[model samples]
Target: MQLSPDEHIFWQYGFVKLNATIVFTWALMLVLAVGSKIITGKLATGLKRSRWQNLMEIVVVAMENQIAEVGLREPRRFLGFIGTLFLFVAIASLCTIIPGFKPPTGSLSTTVALALCVFVVVPLFGIEDQGLIGYFKSYLEPTVIMLPFNIIGEISRTLALSVRLFGNMMSGEMIIGILLTITPYIFPIVMTLLGLLTGMVQAYIFSVLATVYIAAAMGDQGLKQEPEAQQ
Candidate 1:
């Protein structure tokens, strides 16, 4: 189907106008995942260098560096989760340039859903890394009495993640909409670029925090390397 100019540009490039581009984002994500996987294998086999390879290389390296810096002992295991997140948010946020496309992430629902996934996975992976007892103990951190406050803080992190992302994206969208209404000419260009940059940075911020949470739950609660750091 031909995307209405707004939908078309939004789907391909992450531009927004009216409605959120869930369908387009999902379809784009499916295609990118399939294509990236197929192309990654091909690249490993010495396929000719091309734009696609370069793009994928950039993504892979960035993800790897993030995982390493977060101090995840099994950085490779977090690769798929972190990479999928960064890519999804990155694409959804950037696709705002198309005339009609809205960013899915500007809505609290989308950000909450992503945060929920991190909430689920951290505990699951924490158990795998530290066992149930260890996971619980890790939460106690520096003192047993401080556990209650720590638990409350942990729960709030997910809330902060969702709210921060939704607020930033939505605020940007609202400001642009208002400006476009008053003076639709050169102003929107600046807003669009700012939106694009905001989207990219927010995506990185969200995923990196998720990584750190998982790393902590795995017993690196102090964010310091210890001999018995959980892998």
Candidate 2:
């Protein structure tokens, strides 16, 4: 079976090449950009609103609530990053209904890139909230001996995020391809539907994990701010 979209090369130079992963990743991003523009360009504020606006509001509200429940004091602060991550994965999976479309998330490069975004953002968020000295000190929490272990844990979790997402997305695509070759057409169709659902679940899990990581990185800043804001 074609294990990854990376195998489908459309163009190549000595050191650079365009593959399905790159093409689809860009295409998906373009769709998101254009769709967001169109949907939000003429938003209504009165009693009546477009269906697209209503859908967007619902999604934003749901995401905000989810982030809040994850212990973030300001959901909107992280909403743009976390929401985009979720939408990209969710839409990439949903678009599988299109013939010849490959999900970029099925590729290790894409997932790694996504994971790296979280990995980088976590430290930045922590540094922003606690300042460099305070954030770096977190590694030696409770004692200095735990520093190396804390650093190792951070690296390991980032690797885990990438591998877990890549494996799940790639496996689902492989299963659907395999089923199509050996089983009835109807079976593959059902599997495709299941794959879509799986994709959405993966997206939710990935975003939530990212939010949790960021919250942890921020240490007790959110907790400290919450009571002050309430008063």
Q: Could you say which candidate leads in TM-score?
A: 2
Count clashes in each candidate, considering only residues at least 3 apart in sequence or on different chains.
12, 0
lDDT of 1 at 134: 84
| Displacement of the residue 106 alpha carbon in candidate 1, Å | 1.1
For each candidate, what is the lDDT? 0.76, 0.90
- Which residue runs does candidate 1 get wrong by more than 4 Å? 1-21, 34-44, 220-231
lDDT of 1 by residue, 1-231 (tens): 221222323234344443334666566577677887877766744566777788888888889887878787767788899888888888877778876566777777678888899988989888887689988886677898889988788778888989998888888788888898899999988998999999999999988888877877775542346433222
Model 2, 150-188: lDDT tens digits are 999899889999998899999988998888889957998
* CA-only RMSD, every prediction: 6.8, 3.6
- Give the TM-scores of the predictions, in the order they appear: 0.81, 0.94
